[model samples]
Target: MAVHPLSALLSGLVLAASAAHANGDAPAGGEPAAAAQVAGLWCGDGLLHEFSLRLNQDGEQVEGELLRKGRVRSIEGRIDGQVLRTQSTKVGALVLEKQGEELRVTGGDGPIALARGTSFRRSPGATCAS
Candidate 1:
């Protein structure tokens, strides 16, 4: 089987996740905290379904990639404050709302309720770390 770019990208992102996780829930040095955690991959679970997202922040804008099962392409989004809005290339847009240790992305036909518990892991060569 041929290796997919997103697969490697996903793996790399997981590594980033682990490093970025701040168990303390707060940043030291009195540095300003970001509204959204834009430093790695995130996985959202729902019964048999799952979603993965990676946010690469450059300055004030965030470049993101969304991966869904059965689909090779990924959705894209931007972040500002505690909200993340990604525009689907095919249909609708998803909104990711981050509140403390919890996060939720809403869209699709069903209810837009998602739970947060840091499903994303750190990859092999990650640059984002605490």
Candidate 2:
């Protein structure tokens, strides 16, 4: 069977994260890079449960290709102030949080919450706590 490119990339990212941990290298994001890119591609699988989302953010706008068991779907939303209001075309809307370098999608089809170390914020409208 052929490995999906996205899967391979996700796998590589996981390996790198693990290696960095073993080396005691403090991750740059320290929380998650995808949280703030605001205009880049992101993909991750929850440590527990079978959930993964590949999100892309553009300024205050966010949308991504959600993957479920080799199936790809779409999710879209926007960052409103400190809160993230989003909805999936297939699923629905969800509330998200931004803390440090991590942005967590709260109460949704993705996970109880899905978080990652992100490089930056979605846009200038939202700011992290001091």
Cα lDDT tens digits, model 2, 1-130, are: 9999999999999898888766645345544323334344333323412334455666678887555456777778776544456674545546666654445655554433333322223223332122
In TM-score terms, candidate 2 sits at 0.43
Per-candidate TM-scores read: 0.47, 0.43
lDDT measured at residue 45 in model 1 versus the true structure, 0 to 100: 45
- Per-residue lDDT of candidate 1, residues 14-49 (tens digit): 665555545422345434456576556555444313
Clashing pairs in 1: 14-121, 14-122, 14-123, 15-122, 15-123, 18-122
- Which residue ranges in model 1 land beyond 4 Å of their true spot? 1-35, 107-130
Candidate 2, run of 10 with poorest lDDT: 119-128
lDDT of each: 0.53, 0.52
